[model samples]
Target chain A: MNQRSQAVRDLLEAVRAKGFDPGPDGPPPDRCWHEAQVEVGDPAQYPSVQESQES
Target chain B: MQVGELIARMEYEYGYRFQQGDVLLIGVNDQGMGGPQAVLPIEQATVEQQVQGIHEEVLPMVHRDYRNLIMVRYEEFDYHETNGFHDQFTASLDDHPGGFEVVAQYKVDQNRQLYQGYMDQQWASPGLRWTMPGKLPDVSAQMRELGYKEPASSEAEYLRSFQPHPEPGFQPLDQEQEVSHLNRLAPRVSVEVARHALATTASTESIEQQAKARQTLGHLVAYDEDARDAVAYDASISPAKKDALVETYRQAPAKQRPALAAAAGAAWMMSGGGLKAGRAIMAHAYQSTRPSDRALVTAAEVATTRAHMRPEEIQEAFGKEIGTDLEAAEAAHQEWERLYSSTTTQTETETVVETETVEEPDQMQLALEHQMNQPPAPVASSGPEVD
Candidate 1:
């Protein structure tokens, strides 16, 4: 997915909605690639951190 | 976009000349070798900074033999598309053998988190995007509110939903159904036999039995002797029906298919017939493929290629693997091993294959005729095969 794509921006905004701090030095505490499972709210992914939030 | 435009944009953004031989920033994953990583196209993954909290879990599983296009071509970044994944998903990317590093930071802007990395010209291709399901089945109220959706019923349906899991731990559609027959029956054969046979099957096969199994069973591995054996026996048919089987499987509905045993007496004939035929077919399948595809890479190319790096980076990468990667790989390996064994123990008993049941002499004769009709095995004409 395009890092700068508007879709990413909208998704990032949603992720921001959940209250996150993307350290000035890093992308976001909960954000990494899909494989990382940090789950910055990409509905496109499954078996996510949200599962953790559920359990 | 074309390479020229891409390079120009990168140069403008990163503030680097990025001469003809500048480093190309390929795909990165934080799981490579130890602490947080950034797998680069160069030796030791060209990261000036080591990020925090990489998935140390993945460090070991990524050692690979294939030369990722990012490693070979600087201009080839376009080929590796970011599907639905985050750019810095793992914080460190290169977990493969040649963990990349910047030959010379084409442009290192401490302020802007930009490292101009470029690889050689060989990594070009059509853009690839990972096709993965948005999310796995969970008791999500959101999805529940949306309504219940039926399980997929066709290959096209699954493909549309098929999201390629980056973790090789999860069995892909083809392998999920594999009885790990090779693992079981293969052990019944010699290790040499199993390796030889697997190496023998050209990087393709009917795999219908297993593929169909995956489609129906949501993928499985029968680790124990019985289930593994049944899988192996079913897979034995792979050599005989490899091509036709694959064709049938591709079109096969994406659901459980009752084992279609011996569609006709001729099935055995095509499946290479009884014990002897099975052995022959297995041996051939185990052996390296005939006229294997050659890479045609030369030492000169290795030496002269821009892909080469100084001694320091190579040593660093090796150190990472020896120190952190081995442990990580072992962890992932053990986890998968546990998963396999867990599935194995939960196995319901299987019906014995009717290997000798009512062997029709006509079927045997047809098989013999079929063998005679086909050209000689590769062993007869050529030597060992390699890929």
Candidate 2:
């Protein structure tokens, strides 16, 4: 699957695991979801969008 | 007199039993206004006797549903035949028009006598009571194996440490699984949590300003206390809890503080994951039985159930689950009005949370029974107008 699909899956999995509904039961995730998809992508392409740097 | 005769006399003066007529010591009546004198013909000459009888009667009846109507008074007003209809509908505090006191227990009164169609004991705190028809029984057994003991309190307390143990029938995820699943994140999804985490980090950044700015290249979020104040919301984090966190950070030896903050920040950035994951787990936890979506569905069910009720009626039904916060009470009241809108005065708000426990069938044996079963509805679209 593409990275976007994977990220959504991770979130879905997390939500599934949590037994809590996290996604758009209300508003469409659209852009936010697209970004989450990118984050969940393969490590090489996504790298760590999570920076170690802190302010 | 003989020594035995003197001893007998002393014993007679000291020894006494609490006979029926013996005056009992009691707390003095603090009520400035004495209880109403018995208008009904009665032999009990004293008000104390009446109060004692009333107290005796009320105290013995085991508290049934936290509140009760103690008295109901009837008022008669003859319509004067003078001028055309005079308006007397409006009631003011100054006018003590004889009406029912509707005396509930003291604790019940303290909660403002709010009732919800469900949740009986919410006066103390906001409560969540749901019956999950899904979660497997073995999960509880496994927790027992892992020494997960539930607190001897409410059912929700049992949920404190939910380490679901079992050789999950579902296959474990692999590296490919990780890559495949990461595809679905909605960007800026949990910025709220991320922002909160970062905001806290910003306060403690001891590094140089430029370096700190470079290190944290995210949104420079500011506190909107003014807006919060405008809303008249007085929700301040208790200093004690924040101090505890700061202490935990400080105590973790010199070099570890940076790493701790980074971890905390990372955890914050992905906080949306936590909410999402939490909801999913809660759903799956009840999946086999409840077969539904997220917690919002449950909350919506509550909201919809109370939609038509008058504020007082709604409180009467599920007031126990609604906490003391005026905002919370108002929100609950609004939830009742929003979904259950009705012109007619609703006597009751019908809140029906299915209480049946639908035990999941034995997984090992049922594998073959429904192999070609229908696929479950996709999560994204199941909710009302997901887009």
Candidate 3:
């Protein structure tokens, strides 16, 4: 294994030793694909900004 | 693949490097449960970046997918990479996983050294869950051991250390003994120490014991100027106690009332009584005492003369008996206002001048106005005559 993978393994060991079980799961969540499409809404549409300007 | 395996694969494939003090939180949900969803790796550049990323990214994702079980792993590579290193311990509801429950874990990294040293000293045994939910470990002893010192008697922990620890099979002190014990200690220590001791006794002792302790405290507050001032300013003391103390001052002899007047006024202010009421209390106390007592007069004046007091309020508080001190305070306040207004006007004038000077002139308009005003330039252009 590479140095990075070895480091990850060591960290996982410490985490388990500290009683944190990631539980039975495999692969990253499907939401990983949605990360690329994070929406950027218009600033004027924000309620707080509009309220502040009105005030 | 396992979660760790996938993280390694993601790091390798995407060339994502994890540095010291990096945190990674992964959310997972059951496939068909219509529950929480997950997100990809978020790489925050700094502490501020991470905070913003969590607020903007992690929080919304969690809100959208409320059913996800989040597994958070924070890694610090080498202790020496930074001057300080801290561990993060987070816990959430076994069912839902990311909400207000995660606040405690966020605080862990700020005091890493003290916490790590504390955990090492106290709970070094294997498989112990030291940072379990609803359990906050006491680290004041470890903080002291690590040479983290606060002001001498200001800290609650320091005050608590003065309390006598009950031994095994030892009986608690009786009311008389407790009062006697406090009386003996009250004369030797400063007013703050005495106050703290009395407070400690009042919390654990019987009602009669509390009354005796309060009576002794009243004596200290009446006789000792520092004690009265300390009690007045102490925010930790309850408003009810301050009210009682102010009553004690009110009942003091006319000769001693002036000295206690300022303290009483300050206490009144702290108890949410308006400044008007506080000034009235001071004025009443002053009226009871002889006006010849200059020290008492000064104390009353100092109490009454505050920056927030308007001229009208001062006039109403002191009435016809307004001393030179009040007049001087009023004059000083007026002087401050005058200076502030003058400074503001000067700044506004300078800004206007700078704005006018900074703009490029309309050369054509200026030339036309110059031609109209100069009476044909004295016909010098046509003649080109000698001087």
lDDT of each: 0.24, 0.21, 0.32
Q: What is the interface RMSD of candidate 3, in Å?
A: 30.3
Instruction: Name the 10 consecutive residues with the lowest summed lDDT in model 2 chain B.
Output: B378-387
Give the residue spans of candidate 2 off by over 4 A. A1-55, B1-174, B177-361, B364-387
Best by TM-score: 3
Candidates in order, interface RMSD in Å = 25.0, 31.9, 30.3
lDDT of 2: 0.21
List pairs with backbone clashes in candidate 3. B36-B67, B36-B68
- lDDT per residue as tens, model 3, B15-130: 22333344433333333112111222234244344444444444444454333322322342223332221122222132333442221111123222111111234545522122
lDDT string for model 2 (A1-55, tens) is 2211222233334344435444433222222110100001111211211121010
Task: Give one digit per residue, the lDDT tens place, for model 2 in B237-325.
Answer: 11221222222222222222332222221121121111222222233222222112222223222222112111122122221221123
Assess the local accuracy of residue B196 in candidate 1 as a C-alpha lDDT between 0 and 100: 20
Every model's DockQ = 0.02, 0.01, 0.01
When summed lDDT is taken over every stretch of 10 residues in candidate 3 chain B, the lowest stretch is B378-387
Instruction: Predict model 1's lDDT versus the native.
Output: 0.24
Looking at model 2, residue B49 earns an lDDT score of 44
